[model samples]
Target: MMKKIILHGATNCGSSNFGDFLYGVAVYNYIKENYKDIEVGFYNPSEYFIKYIGDCKISLSKSDMLIYIPGGYFGQSHKSRFIDNAIQFVRFMPVGIKAIFKSIKIGVIGIGAGPIISPFLKYPIKMIGNKAEMISTRDNESYNALKSLGLDNILELSDLILALNIHNLSDTTDQVVDICKKCEGRKLLFVHYNHSLLARDIFARQLDTFVEENPEYQLVVGSDCLLSYDDEYYIEFSKRVKKNCIQFNYDSPFELIALLERVDAVLTCKLHVGVVATMLNKPVVCFAEHPEKTKRYYRQINQPDRCVSLYDTSEEEMLSILKDKIFEKSFVPDEEIDKAKRNFDVLNELINKK
Candidate 1:
């Protein structure tokens, strides 16, 4: 019988990253709506682990269960360095260890893992996976990665963001609402590019060409990450594209979803932007820099061709794909959303097993 569950992850509680923020929102709402009786608390490992001796320690000590929410926290990618991966593992190790010592059941849901190069890191991660009462991954690649570490009883689940009911969550900004109202007749395409990706000028030129060709369509450039650099990059990119383009200043996840719900389609390098657009039944063409997670997600939804290489794919080809996607009937199947909800089934089962 679980009494309290601490959702531990790099979630919205301490994050400005819209994707992680939405994941935290989705999981929290799910638990509150379904369980009703269980006490829910959020513990952001990235922010709180540094001050582990304070509220972090107290929260974990009192929790009956610690649930690690969805994200690509467990593996190495082009965007994340080996040192980054090591630091993340280090932050999580103490939390997991303390949870075990306190007899708090641990659950990992809809997480992604892979390409763990170091044996030293692998050993400790394996220990946590083996000790976890329930473990599930968002993709098969992640499942295989855990399987390589000899972990068993892992379930494959969809991304938790799919389970989010965007319509139910209100709080759209006046700016976004007004923009949607103004662009009633024109097709709006939500565009987000990773600022760190190489060849910004080239990508900007490609977008300019796409806009020039598609005069009926309007571009709304924005960042999924609310960092200074991302905002700066989009501001500059918006200038270079001498077409119908508006720079979106991200205020909140609710506003982001509101804009996404109104958009005709999404063209982005960020994984969650594509995921959110898909959830809204909007077509998305992903310019993947770190292609693993994005590619895996598209493939999972039976649309592998939508994920394209950011650098390698030609501008003309990208424009063609974007045009096709904009008009096509692309949507996330109802079954996929149903599958994502099952990520919580393990936790529910544990709570029921008096």
Candidate 2:
């Protein structure tokens, strides 16, 4: 019988389109490709919790390889809720519930970044060691952090961004190649615009000045770069920067990969857009809202030189930093990828035997 697998999480609900989609890509590529006898199912834990946890996922666990995802490891805490007293609430009840439910035998895979130092991570780390089959986190620091906590069945894997298949995409690659022909040697820079956010005005205004200052480069926009492509601010930016501007949103993953492969440089506010651009080895300027999480992620990958903060950055500071990083090599290697793959494979064996 084919083993049944379930991917479940509430941290990333439907509204969290990027991370949700990326996790899907990883499952599709990793387990689905390798295990033909495995049948897959996806679930939303928050939705499942509306009724129950163990019952909702019982079918998944009953199979030979039950794949629990992003489990509710961050046990109950008073700080967990917006209520006046969050920690006291979560700590006692959740801890007791977790202790009671620790015996289920199931294959587990955790796909997300780690929280710093707290019960937030501590519980996940504990459950991953106790209840899970294997845990695959987003970066090396997280992997090391979990290991320091005495975690055994864990691995430092690349972000799900690494799992997206860009190889064997000839026709879409041709489209990207055709797009590249316009400015094969010249740099193609992307600027994000949106009115829903506070910094869009500042970013767009700076971009206008930037375009006038540097006629040598072309500008572009990627999907979700703005809340809407036709938002007034973006529309004006697009109009003023028309001649060499491209606003692209390809629904197909293959086409998007091919499109991004041709870019020389990218300055992005969207999280996955920056991450995916970095994955393609395109020079990236991460104009993050806080740059807190983004910097942590970049540092985890050993690409700090390519990261910059928008927290207190002036237009001039951003422009200068953009120029400096644009020409540098920021590629994650095949060796690193191989290591992640090895860890993933070994984890499967451990889970099966257990």
Candidate 3:
């Protein structure tokens, strides 16, 4: 039977993070390949609020089904603001209830929990989970978190971006490729977000020290999120290094994947950046803001030693880990990719069930 499916996540948002954008791509591609006859519509969560509550030209209607893409946004709070929490509750609760009323099958994929400072958010999230026909969490911590709230049917699936077929994707532009391949076998990619300014600076100093110590390798900065704070930190880090670090504007996920192929290893604080590197079979040293989420992902791919806690681990420890672990060759097994693909099967089964 054909259905009008409304896929929701951080899609088509101007300020969306690249990692989130990749999740959208993965979900969209999977859906298009599987459900060719279904009418699919996209909704950005940020924009959903604007259209739902504010005066907007576009509006969201009750659909036959709703699929929320996989991402670590369940417990991610911005400033831990009460008003923000209130708005989120109001924004999602009504839709979730409406979905139930309309018998709209709801699915949430590759979502994680934690850093949820507010107790108020627990009920709303639980409500959505209870209403969902299928909930595929990306990591165990997320599964545990959601299970702790009495939601027991969640599947502990890995991140969906791992299922993306990057092997067939086109390479980046010649200019970008040339810049990325400057040092050939000695190119290392660095990616980080601006959640903590102090941590960002600490990484910058460490990167400078690493560059000075290892003159053979060239550091290349990759932007995962297009935030002003991150851009400013990149500039600051480049200046402090006193070396020419090549920075590339990855406007799309394919370009970033191409750049990853050109680099030897990845050192990143962002979750998806590290995941993508591992997908490309490159060694990655991850600085995890939420240790649970990163550890969960690493555990899935059988690389538990790759995740380092930003709070507990020092810069020297991270650099040491990079030297000991990240430089070594790593292989992403075919079984791992198959495991991620199984998540899509779970999604399809839930959606197409009688």
| Cα lDDT listed for each candidate | 0.74, 0.53, 0.68
Estimate candidate 2's alpha-carbon lDDT, on a 0 to 1 scale. 0.53
User: Quick one: ranking by TM-score, best first?
Assistant: 1, 3, 2
Cα shift from native, residue 306, model 3 (Å) = 1.9
For candidate 1, the per-residue lDDT at 71 reads 84
Query: lDDT: which is higher, 1 or 2?
Result: 1
Worst 10 residues of 2 by lDDT: 48-57
Which 10-residue window in model 3 sums to the lowest lDDT?
Answer: 50-59
TM-score of each: 0.89, 0.70, 0.86
Q: Residue 33 error for model 2, in Å?
A: 3.0
- The list of candidate 2 runs beyond 4 A from truth reads 9-12, 15-19, 44-110, 116-129, 144-152, 163-165, 169-187, 192-199, 224-233, 236-244
- Kindly list the per-residue Cα lDDT of model 2 for residues 135-170, writing each as its tens digit: 676566556666776767776565544544545431
Worst 10 residues of 1 by lDDT: 48-57
Q: Write the per-residue lDDT of candidate 3 for residues 246-319, one digit (tens) a residue.
A: 77665555666777877777777767778877877787887776565676778777787888787788777887
Task: Report clash pairs, candidate 2.
Answer: 76-90, 76-91, 77-86, 77-87, 77-90, 78-86, 78-87, 78-88, 79-86, 79-87
